[model samples]
Target: MKNCCQAPARRLFAYPPTSKTPTPSADDTVRPQPTPSKQNRGRPHSGRGTKRPAIPALPNFLPKLNPGSQLVMDRIYSQLLLFQLFFTGSVVDTIVKNTNTFARMRSEAGKHFLWLPLKAEELHSYIALVIYMGLLGAKNIIDYWSGKEIYRLPFPKSVMSRSRFQAISWNLHLCDPEDDRENSQKKGTQAYDRLFKIKPLYNDIVSACKTYFHPDRQLAVDKRMVATRARIGIKQYMKDKPTNWGYKLYVLADSACGFTWNFFVYEGKSSLATGKGLSYDSVMQLLDLSLLGKGYQLFMDNFYTSPCLFMDLLAKKTLACGTIRTNRRRDQRGTIRWLRDGKLLFVKWIDTREITVCLTMHMAYDGDAVLRRVNNPEREWERRRIPIPVAVKDYNIYMGGVDLSDALIGYYNVLHKTTKWYKTFFHFVDIVVVNSFILHQHLSKAQNKNPLSQKEFRERLVSELATQSSTSEPSTSAISAGEPCCPEYFGSDAASGRRVCALCKLSGLKVKTPMYCTKCNVPLCLVPSRNCFRKWHTVGHS
Candidate 1:
């Protein structure tokens, strides 16, 4: 039997060294003969045909605009409007119902707690308060509601009571509790889903993200860590990531603005693996089939780059470029190797070190150079232009989209310290806010207006969500024909005849005042601390 590796070497050195010597030149200087070495070895012919294959032309990358995206852009003129796209009525109702059901279950199990059914309006306020807390970070959750002048945040207290917020956070559930038994029975089986607890909310959010915007020509795929210390099975630890401990998410984002177009939660071995390895399956899972064959360029890291994967992407009319591992593909030092198979180009180029890149969209080296500071013999650093591969240059430029998204999210992350694993939903809330802000910037540029910063966008969003009225009309009944029908407030001279203010009671405040509305015939507070009378007439009627 012959060694398989020796076949290439035997073919490379098939012609032996010749005994004949070259004649001297006119100056009687004999030219030296070139020697055969690894670096100067002649190019190997492609097995397909005698003619060298031409480099495939780069396809024009024009992303197909999603039809629904235009409708969303037209409808979303405000931060609240964009937010409502993700948190629709059905989404909020699901949260409200599940939270109430969980609280009821806990109450029935002898947990000593008051169980007031959560309303959709109150849930909105709760979410607003949570986002506010993230914006104004604190040392502790109770610090926002602290009585101390330095620690108190009036916005959170004004939105919802601290106790009520705590209650909702503690019992915030995504799925029905009764399904636990049925889920447990399927454990360790093929039907088991580790993410079933938050699957509905997760699916809804993912769908909304894909529906609202079409990504640009350049896109990047990578993984992010949502920091959490919870003792859950799905938690992962990545030493390379800034957040070493948390849930891992495979994300696909737009390279231009860092808009997260899609994401998949990593569930360890139980995740959807297509037998092609985790990295391959993760990229495939995050890619939208509708966006394929439309000339989009994808950039990824060495973890996801492979010959088979790049060829697969090329088959679908999508172009990709990424670094490869030495174990997966061999590299030679101080040499440039170009191997072409069909439309895919496999290049191994030497800069400071050898780098193997598999690409379908870029030439091996297009005379592009990048400036680098080098240490000279005098021990001084000098800027020098070094020739680089086009594929490597592009990979460096557009491969940080996921990292950019992670950085923006880290600015005002809403994920707080909580034992309840469902609280991870707050990470998704932060993602939604980041995506909305990116869209906001694009729309602002299109309309020739200045865009708000992420901080400003979140503040405006919190205000709208916290103060938005649940009902489009007034909760009060129409005034009768015989009623006073006047919409003004009147104060009685007798202060002793004070009654509980109607509007103040609804806002979790108890106040007694002699002021009454003439038309509605309801007692309302008129003091500076509690302006129930003016609020009732303004908000209740209008």
Candidate 2:
């Protein structure tokens, strides 16, 4: 709204006018009026050019144009709708109080300053952003504080201006104590002070927002991974080259209502260790716990099941339940009896290294007291082998009768909308789990509904997997003609398949070298050897 054409000067009728108008005696009788000047008629009657008023300029300036400025508002508005419906907006208020509320982050986590200038709040940008995004209803930063959106959000335009973007991107509050602060003192220097200095009065004022509105009760561990090429290619195992693809971040959020307990970012190989492996070391590391004990219930799939792994979990006091390897291939001489149909039956297999193990825990439960009952009086819980869907169950054997697979369950479920879309399955599962926890803690909880304890939760989960098959009609075809034989949740690129070690394929090649088997950490050689590795690698073979 600029006035491109300056208005023509007005002929005023006030004292000492730029142009003179008829002036009558102070107490004279009314006289005939003359034609009025068009401009002077509506113009304020003032001393005219004799005393001009000063106009001040407004101060938001930006050299770069924000591309998303146009859609920001609509995006925010729509996203806000979804966020409001799902999450209780208290996390936003909690985020605003990070430093001011926690108080410990500043003391423990924010110990050092960095070469880049910073404030206290910048130290917790990752966590704060999660809380802010989940609670504030902004999908990502592009939609929030946008020039067109947040500028109208009762905040000034400078907050989203292009200059501020560059100014703040450099580790603003990520300061290291021994960092070169003095270097920033001079102009044209990349040092902290000179690189981009805020006026001295406002310096060091960077800290957690003093005005955060929510308390701990309303807060949750919020997380968001901004797409990045590196993380996408590596963390999520998206094999596509990083020529242009951005990353995807998986976050654990508590928008439902709880404190943020843990959060992390994996640049590429998605949750291989944490989500799939259920590795004690991985879980402990992910939770940032030191010697938090090894025993804990690890809920996961077959990719994580192993006797050694099971023992590890038990050592840590963790109960692991999922599918287990029956090892029926080899007819060992030893007889292993399993409790079946309330009777001990001798099976052909034995507990031996010759037969490998593979299993997954579909659900995990732990508490002060434990109780379980079998639904069928004849079938014992230990012998009742609840099966996953056939498609996913035989995923590894899809190509042939049998092949090694980190999982077979994926093939059993095509994960279509008619079937269970992986996204919906996982999302539904997440909701069920989180909300169940909440229900147990705060909601009206019901004791196990089945008085007879007919079905274990895992069996129930498997039953839910039976598909309507098709959105229109229940059909068995999972992959529509020639569609990649992979689950939607399995990730897009099939090239992310695990790799075979050079030595594993070198029986006919050059000299073999000694290597510690990753799973067992024991010295093992290449040719004709199946060595046990102590530490679990999510990529089993690779």
Candidate 3:
């Protein structure tokens, strides 16, 4: 023990103290501070161990949508055509098949179920009735079919029988039973699919949404809750949301017209964890890469705002702006502090309270002022123009896309109470309708025509979908024998070419044919199922 300490003590004492301490000079009393480099001189402290320039003015080159990629008319003039764009024949066919299969399965299981095989036309009528129900809300589902004078609705009774509507509602399925059973048996990562029951329908709808319309420059990402009290594992409780207890869905929508471009159901902790953070991954997942790199501007809130995500989006040529959490990075020591790193701008501004925002598209400052009414010392309200950052102004303007969508959906929400969780598909139906309505507005504006209100649009849509066939006898004067209109071959061959039937188009049916009226010079279907030629002649077209 003595030997172990002796060597260390000798080394420590090797340097002897000076005999007399040197006297301190005035010059040595205080160390000279080094001069700041040009890069950092006069820069304000950003409270994060770095100095940054004062908030700069708004940049000139704000991202604008490419001219060629501007919104063009989809050429879908009818409400039915726009609706069919999202709910295609394939989607309808799948629903019909799965619904029939599920009904048959129930019958085989000895359940007291009377189910006729579902047809595509009948299913369309059923959906139309559902939309109608949303418009005329009743206390109970049976009220729409009730014989009582106050409860009776002619539309529902005419479109579908009460028994048939109940049958479809009870057994409607979106995925095949066999496939779902097989998938359930899978272990580990594959076994637990929260949306397994409705995955097929969900995929088709999402794919169609992306394919049909490209979003404009300003887009927003937010979460929406589908109100439900069903005892399902995926149900979430968001206290701040109006529909507080329900299934949560993250939606990316157009800020201009509230068009839902893409959405996904929020599963749970296990499914959402992606090594990054939940907020970061959720935003990344909802965004389509094809839509990026095209001068698109994305807006979000504190939930999804992070330096990493904004940088990643910038790298792809997509601009983003949103409020951020101070705890996520550094806290601001003073009001209106900002930091600029390359193209990224971080702003900590105080309005009513503190608000931290991160944006890549806008400059840190622009001489913009927003009017705010404040109570003066006399206890009277007075208006004042407060300076607002450009980022804050734009964020306030464009961050409500999802909220706008929710408001529009709620106005005529088709969702009804149900014990089964899969019935949440009704929410998606409402989403499709809203998207179609938005597209209709855009198309109507482009064509210099007034767009129908949402109520009118849905009414027209329901009527078109509920109509059974185009060949329905037209209520018109009978054709005279002296009329020269007669059916003749119009195309070189039936398989080579065809055109839309004049009569069928008038009846809101998209029927194509190779036969034409000799004198009228318009195509008309001559097939056995659709005798548009004879029907057109019978209708007395000149």
lDDT of each: 0.70, 0.25, 0.70
Candidate 1 — which residues are off by over 4 angstroms? 1-54, 60-62, 66-69, 72-76, 270-272, 291-293, 327-338, 349-354, 469-542
Q: By lDDT, is 2 or 3 better?
A: 3
For residues 76-97, write the lDDT of model 2, one tens digit per residue.
Answer: 2221222222222333223223
Report model 1's TM-score to 2 decimal places. Answer: 0.75
Residue-level error in angstroms, candidate 2, position 302: 3.0
For model 3, residues 197-236, the per-residue Cα lDDT tens digits are 8887899889878766767778899999998888887889
Candidate 2 off by > 4 Å: 1-151, 156-162, 171-226, 230-281, 284-295, 323-542
- By TM-score rank, best first, the candidates go 1, 3, 2
Which pairs of residues clash in candidate 3, taking residues 3 or more apart in a chain or in different chains?
none
Q: How many backbone clashes does candidate 3 have?
A: 0
| Worst lDDT 10-window in candidate 3 | 5-14
TM per prediction: 0.75, 0.26, 0.72
